[model samples]
Target: MKCCFGFVTLFVCSASVQAQEANALVQQVKARLEKVADYQATAQMDINVPFINAPSSEVQVFYRRPDKFRVQKPQGISVLPKGGVRINLAALLAGNNYTVVDAGTAAVGGFNTRVVKLLPSDESGPVVLSTLYIDAAQPVIRKTTVVAREGGSYEMLFDYGRYTAWGLPDKVTFVFSAKEFKMPKGVTFDYEKSGPKKDPPKGDGKGRVVLTYKSYTINKGVPDAVFKD
Candidate 1:
C-alpha cells in the first residue's frame, strides 16, 4: 500500500513485524532464497515519470549471492531508483544488523501477506527502515516499502510466476516520487533561469518503474566483471 507521508506514516502501520518468530519467518524466506546462488534474467523495463520522456526497452539483469547486481541495456541508459537500494531482496535482508516488528497484514497478488517492519540498527546504512509484505503460504516477499537514510524512498510490488520457488518475481513494480528523484551523479541539464527559480512543476509526484521478466537462467555464474562495468 502507498503511504501519504512516506516513512512517518508507515510506523503507524508497523506493529510487530520483527519479533521472536517473526525472525523465524524472515529466516524461512531467506532460506528459500538461498537455493539460488546466482541468476541472469532478461526483462522488459518501462519507466513512467510525469516529468521525463522515456521509452520502454529490454535489459539484462544479473544478480549473485550476498549482493552483486547489474542492469545491462546495450547502447542505452537505464533509469532506476537510487539511494543505495539493491534490487536483490537477499542483499536487503542479509545480516542481523536490524530489528523487526509485525507491521500487520496486506494482500498482494491476491495473497494475504503478513506485513513485517524492519528497522536497521546501523544509522550509517543507506536503508533506514523497510516494511515487507510476506506471502502467507510460501516463503516470498510479496511487497516492500523502503526508506533510504538519504533521500530516496520507494515501494516494490512483486508478481511471481515462473520462479516463485526461488522467491523471484516474474514482474516487479517500483513506485516512487518523481519530484524527489535525483538525477544520476555526473549528469546535468540546462534549465531556464526564470528569476532565479520558479515554483517546482505542479503535479502528483508519482513515479514508477516496471520490470517484466521474460526468462531467467538460474544457477549460472555471472562473472564479477559484469558488476564492475
Candidate 2:
C-alpha cells in the first residue's frame, strides 16, 4: 500500500511540474515579442467566401511599429489602425484591456504547445476573441485564431523558419469560416446576390496566407511624410 501511494504522489508532482513548465513557455514568448520595436513585411491575403467562384488574392505591404500597423492592400482598401498603431498584433491584443486565459495544451506544427485565449474586455469592440498557440520548446508563436464581432473566426498558422530566434514569423497562413464572408456589393449595394447561393469551397476548412519579411530598418528616424498619402 505504501508503494502504491508513493507512485501516486510521484505522478501528481510530475503533473504539477509540467504545468509550470508550460506557463513558463508562454511567458518566454511574450517576453520576446515585447523586445521587438518595429518590423516590415510583405503579405499575401487570400479571401475565400461562399458563392464566390474563385478565391481573391491581395498583395499587401505591412509596416508594424510597437503597437500600430499599416496594411496597404490592393484597391486602396486599408484597415483602420487601433491598439496604439505601433504594436504588433500579439502585443496589441494582449494589452491590459484584454484578458488572457490559459486554455490548456495542444500540438501545433508538431511542437507541443500551450493555448492562450485572449478575450477583449469590450464585447462591443471589433474583435470578439483571439487565441494563440505558443511553442513550449522555444519562445515562438506557432498559430493564432481570431474571431471578429462582425466577421467570422479566422485561424492563422505561422511558420517560423529563418527568423525563429528573431521572434518574428517568416510565414503566416489564414483559414476562416465562409458564413462570415460578405460581398462588398452587399455593403455598397453594388452587386446583388442571385438565386440560391452555394456554400463556399471547403478544403479541410483551411486557407493559407504567407508573409515574407525582407528587412526591418529600426528607428531610422522615419519622416512624417512617409506616413502621408
Candidate 3:
C-alpha cells in the first residue's frame, strides 16, 4: 500500500512540474515581447490560392501592445486571414485566462522547439485553442496554430532577423481555409486567375497569405487612430 501511494505522489509531482515549466516558457515569451510598446512595419502581402486573383500589394502594418493591430494598403486589396489579431503571438498569450499544456516537442522553422497548447477558460470565447512552438534557447516562438470556436483552424509561421531583438519577425505566413474568406460585392477583381465562382469551393481548401516585412520601426508609439477602420 505504501509503495502504491508513493507512486501516486510521484505522478502528481511530475504533473505539477510540467505545468510550471510550461507556464514559465510562456512568461519568458511575454517578457521578450514587453520591450516593444508599438511598431510599424512595411510588408508585402501575397495571397496564394487557386480561385483568388489577388496580386501582391505593399502594406503597412501597425501594432500596439495588448491588442491594437491594423493593416493598410495605399490602393490595392489586402486579403488577411480571418483571425488576424490572434496571429500576433505576444497578444495571444498576454491574457492569463487560459490554461497551458505541454504538447511535447516538434521541429518548427528548422529548430527543435517545445509545443504548448492554450485553451481559453471562457467557454464562449472566439478562440477555442492556440498552440505555440517555442524555442527556449533562442527564446522565440517560431510558429502558432489557432483553432476558432467555429470549427476552423489556422497556422502562422514566423521567421526572424534584423528585428529579432524586439521579438519581431521579418516574415510571417498564415495558412487558413479559403471558404472562410469573402469579398464585398461590386468590388471588381481582375478575375485573370479566378475563372468563375461556382458556389464557392466546398470543403476545407487551404489558402496561404505571406507577409514579408521589409522594415520595422519599433517602440515608436502608434496612435489609436492608426487602428481605426
Q: Pick the candidate with the highest lDDT.
A: 3
Model 3, C-alpha of 57: deviation from truth (Å):
2.0
Tell me, by TM-score, which candidate is best: 3
Better of 2 and 3 by lDDT: 3
Best-to-worst ranking by TM-score: 3, 1, 2
Native-referenced Cα lDDT, model 1: 0.74
TM-score of each model, paired residue for residue: 0.79, 0.64, 0.84
Question: Which stretches in model 3 have alpha-carbon errors above 4 Å?
Answer: 76-85, 178-205
Give a tens-digit lDDT track for model 2, residues 9-126: 9999987776666556656776777665555555554434454433334444444444445555566555333321112444544455766666888998688878877678887876
Off by over 4 Å in 2: 1-24, 43-60, 73-88, 91-94, 180-199, 205-208, 218-229
Candidate 2, TM-score vs. the true structure? Answer: 0.64
Candidate 2 weakest lDDT stretch, 10 residues:
183-192
Error of 3 at 33 (Å): 1.2
